[model samples]
Target: MARGSDRKRPDFYSRKAKASGRAARSVYKLEEMDQRWRILAKGQRVLDLGCSPGSWLQYAAEKIGPQGQAIGYDLKPVNATLPAHAEARIGDVYELDIEALGTFDVILSDMAPNTTGDRKTDAWRSAGLAENAMLIAQQSLKPGGHFIAKILEGGDVPELIKKLRQNYHKATQTRPKATRKESTEIFLVGLGKRH
Candidate 1:
């Protein structure tokens, strides 16, 4: 039998990431997605959800560069300092006033629900978070923009996909290589937002 602590052990990505100065290993996920699908571009505006450790924001700032804007919001204070063009704020997604942040060319969400270890309950909660992210994207995403949000593979994802299909030119699910083999998480990529 496998020890519970063993499951918590960091893998290769974590080790390399620790040495690479990334605040979180999740930077690889966004990097891979952007490389594969061109999700980010220089001079575009981006908003990141649940960006506490700020690794995603770090990578985003690099890709967006000085000409672009990267705005991150989370319930806790961001752990890393952002670039001049990037800003991190303490805020809750459910209560966030997105109008103040303005519209963006892209929105990325890696929000994870507080898991209880019950797969069904965890899936439900994750689905709820994805739903809220979609609503936020609708409110803040520019026409013909893009959205990428992490979500559990099961639960109410079909409904979410259906909703995205109606609003976006393309909706697809992708899992980056950086994701753990056992992880049920996947990214829902919504391309060409049609407001």
Candidate 2:
């Protein structure tokens, strides 16, 4: 038997995901953001970064429909079966060539640093990943596209937001209800990417 700390507890979202045959509970986060912000649309090409377990890609595939394509990349392999419109590859974000992959209508990143237990270190690392995602979005997103990236609250976040504001028509941040209570992660949404 597992100890109290070692035991896994399924929350309401997790149970819903299992019932709906979704990859993971993280799908709901993207759902809420998309619903509230009108991010994903049918026939839009999407690029998903750090898409391990592929919950976001699954959600994107449904939103974008068969006419659209959702491509995902992550350090770990995704074992789930993806929709015909979606595909995932194992790769590091830092090494990816955004230009070679071509442009996208939407770019999403759920990357987080491997936690070190120290909040500051973790947040800083998350900031770095978020920055990289922003760079990819800037380079690869078509005009009037959208970008969403997850970043832990850290000192560097304001600087990152400043850059987002300069590059996108509208830049905002949100903490989705699906996020864990203790998690410091917040998502930065950049709507209407400027050329």
Candidate 3:
């Protein structure tokens, strides 16, 4: 019989957070996606959802530079201060009007639903968040734009993937090196918006 003491531990995020000077190691996931997909560019407009702690915003601000613009939103206030070029709004993403923010070259969502320890329930909630973010992306993203968002391990992900495929030139799922091995979380990256 296996004992609880025998369970393996994963610390990829801790090590990455230390090395990268980020609030959380999840920033590397965006970095990896950007590297693989070339989603970010100089002078482009970017939006970040659930951007608390501002790690993704920090990375985006650095990548987009002064000529570019990066806007972030979250229900809770971000504890970290952002760069001069980056702006953050404290609000719910689902309620926000995407048109008011203008079109973006890239949209990134790292939103995670509050986990209840029930796998199925958690998955559904996470998927809902992803769905909302996708709708916002569709409304505000420029043609040929990019989107990256987090999703749980289960719940109608195939359908979501199919829809993404229809809207983007390519859509892929990636588990970044920065994510803990024990976590069921994954990222979906959509590139080259179709319309």
Candidate with best lDDT: 2
Residue 81 error, candidate 1, Å: 3.1
Model 3 residue runs over 4 Å out of place are 1-12
| Candidate 2 lDDT tens digits, 52-134 | 88789999999999999999999988887898999999899999977789999999999877777788988888899999999
Q: How far out, in Å, is residue 76 in model 1?
A: 1.6
| Clash list (residue pairs), candidate 1 | none
Measured by TM-score, the strongest candidate is: 2
RMSD to the hidden true structure, all candidates: 3.2, 3.3, 4.7
Error of 1 at 19 (Å): 1.6
Q: Could you give candidate 1's per-residue lDDT for residues 76-180 as a string of tens digits? A: 777776899998898879999878889999999988877778878877887887889999999999999999988887778788889999989999889889888
TM-score of 2: 0.94
Off by over 4 Å in 2: 1-8
TM-score of each: 0.93, 0.94, 0.91
Instruction: Rank the models by lDDT, top first.
Output: 2, 1, 3
Ranking by TM-score: 2, 1, 3
Report clashes for each candidate as comma-separated counts: 0, 0, 0
